[model samples]
Target: MPEQTQDDTGRDRDDDGRARNARPRDRFGRPLPFGSAGVPRIPEDLDLPPAETLDYAQRLLDEGLAFNAHEVLEAAWKNGPFAEKSLWQGLAQFAVGLTHIQRGNAKGARTLLKRASDRLSAYGTAPYGIDSPGLVDRAHTLLMALEQGKPISDTDLRARLTISH
Candidate 1:
C-alpha cells in the first residue's frame, strides 16, 4: 500500500485496493485499518429500557469499542428522560475520556476523566445500572497512571472496566 500523503485528501482510494481511510473506528474513535465492519449503532428511538441501553454500552465497552459505546450513552443523555440525563452524560464523558486515551492525548484524557468522575459522582453508585462509584475510582486510578507516565491500552481498559447492575 502506498503511504498516505498530504495530497491524499480524498477518502478511501488506495493504490493496492487495500482498505485505507475507512471511517470505522475503535472504541476510542481511532481509525482502525480492519475489523468492525458491523459496529452496532443506537436506534432512532431513545425509548429503550434502562437495562437494554446499559447493556448495549457494556457490550461495546467490553469489545474495546469505547467511541461506539459513547454514541449510545450520548444518545441516552440527549434523548432519555430529563431526570437521568446527568447519568447518561457522565457515561458518555467516561467513554470520551477513554477515547482520548486511544488518541494518545494524555492531558485531554485526564481532564475528561476528572470531569466525568465529578459528574458521575453526583449520581452516586448504581444509578440506572451504572456503577458510578466504581467508574470514578477506576478513572482516578487511570489518571494517576497517566500522571506517572504509564501507558494505557485497550486490553488494560477492558481489564479495568466492568459495567454492572
Candidate 2:
C-alpha cells in the first residue's frame, strides 16, 4: 500500500502533492483542464527555407485551400526577415481575409483585407514593386464590395485576376 499525505483541506494527497493532480494553469493562472490547452507548439526543426515557404503558400492558394495558404504564409511572414517582408505580410493578411470571405463573414473579411491593402499601399512600388501595388488594388476592390453589403461576385472577381477558387 502507498503512503499518503494530508493537505490543508484534509484531502488525502498523492505522493508529490502536486495540487491534487489538477491541470496546469495558464498565463493568467487560471486552471486549464486536461487536453483543453489547444494546439501544440511547432518544432524549431520544422522551419522551412524561405523559397520553400513561399512555394507552399502559392501551392495552397492555387489549390483553393485559402485557410491553409493563410496559415503557411502567415508563418512565413512572421518568421521572415526578407526584403519584402511587408509585401508577404500583406499577402498573408489578404489570404486570411479571403478565407473569411469564403466562410461568409463579410465584416471580418473587410477588416483584414483593408489592413492588407493599407500595408501594401504604404510599401508602394519603391520597395515592394509592382506586385505589391496589384495586391493592394485587389484588396481594395474586395473591401469596397464588402463594405457595400454586396456579395463578392465570382465573375467580376475572376475578370480582374485569376484566383484558384
Candidate 3:
C-alpha cells in the first residue's frame, strides 16, 4: 500500500484515489507541492544531441515523468533540425497529454492526445526513430477510453515506447 499524505485539514486525500492535488501551494520560491516560482533556464550553449535527447526522454517517460519528458521533447523541437521540428512537436504534445493523464485531467488529456495523434498521423509508421503508428494507436486507445468511460490503469498506455539507439 502507498503511503498517504495529509491535506491542510489533515485528511488523507490520496486514500480516495484523488490524483488531482487541490491544495494551493505556497507562493514563495521554496519547494511546495505543485508550486515552482521559477525554473532555471537550460543553457543555450549546451547542445543536446538528438540521440541523447531521445534517450533522456525515453527514460523520463518510462519513469512516468511525462511532464519532464515533455520539456525535453520541447527542447528538441526548438533545437533540432527544421525538417523534423513538427515530429518533435508532435512527440512533445503526446508527452504533455500523458502528463495530463497523470495529473487526473481527463479532458485535457483527451484534447492533447487527439491533437498529438492528428499531428503524428502525418508521419505514418516511422519518423525520427519512433514508431509513429504504434504511438498513434496508443493515443487513440487512451482517447477512446476517456470517451467511453473505461478505467485506465497507469500502465494501459503500452506501445512503441522506446527510441532506436
Candidate 4:
C-alpha cells in the first residue's frame, strides 16, 4: 500500500496553514462531495451590527436555511459585545433548533429550543428590538407541536427575529 499523506493534526487546513473545513456544504450545512457545488458559506469572522445580523439571519431562516442562519448568529455571538453574548447565543440556539428539525433530529430540536427559550426569557424585555417574549412563545409552541407529533413545515418554522415597526 502507498503511504498516506498526513498532517500533524489530520485536519483540513487553509493555504496559510490555519485549520478550516474547506468542504462545500449544502443549504442545510451538510458536507457535500469535494467537487460538488454547494451553498455559499457564512464567514466565521462575520461581525455585523446587531440590526444587520438579525436581518441577515432572518433572511436565511426565511429561505429555510436554518443551519446557515445559525452560523451567522454564532459568528455574532462569538464576535459581538460581551453584554449581548447571551442574546446572540440564544438566537443561534433557536436557529440550530430549527436546523435539527430540518435534519429530522427531534430530540436535538427539543433540547435546543428549550435552551433558546430559557436564554431569551432572561431578557424580560425586547433588546435591540428583538422580540424575545415572542421567540420564547414560539419555542414553546414548536415544542408543543413536536410533542404532539405534528409536522412542522419549513414555512411554519421560519422565525421573525425582530418586532415589525
Best by TM-score: 4
Give lDDT per model, in order: 0.73, 0.61, 0.71, 0.87
| Full candidate order by lDDT, most accurate first | 4, 1, 3, 2
Q: 49-83, model 4: which lDDT tens digit per residue?
A: 98899999999998999999999999999998898
lDDT of residue 44 for candidate 2: 23
> Which lDDT tens digits does candidate 1 get at residues 1-113?
35533334556644555544544654456665546664544443455667777888787888877777787888788878888888888888888888888788999889988
Alpha-carbon runs more than 4 Å astray in model 3: 1-46, 163-165
- Residues 1-165, candidate 2, lDDT per residue (tens digit)? 234567889665666664342344332223466666723322222356666765666666565556566666667667777776786687778877877777778888888899888877886663312356666677888888888888785433321112222
The local lDDT score (0 to 100) that residue 139 gets in candidate 4 is 95
**How well is each residue in 37-100 modelled by candidate 3, as lDDT tens digits?**
4443223233588777777778777766676677788888898889888788888889888877
Q: Can you list the residue pairs that collide in candidate 4?
A: none
Best model per lDDT: 4
User: lDDT for model 4, on a 0 to 1 scale?
Assistant: 0.87
Q: What's the TM-score of each model vs. the native?
A: 0.72, 0.59, 0.69, 0.90
After superposition on all C-alphas, the RMSD of every candidate to the true structure, in Å, is 7.9, 10.9, 11.2, 4.6
Clashes of 1: 3
Better of 2 and 3 by lDDT: 3
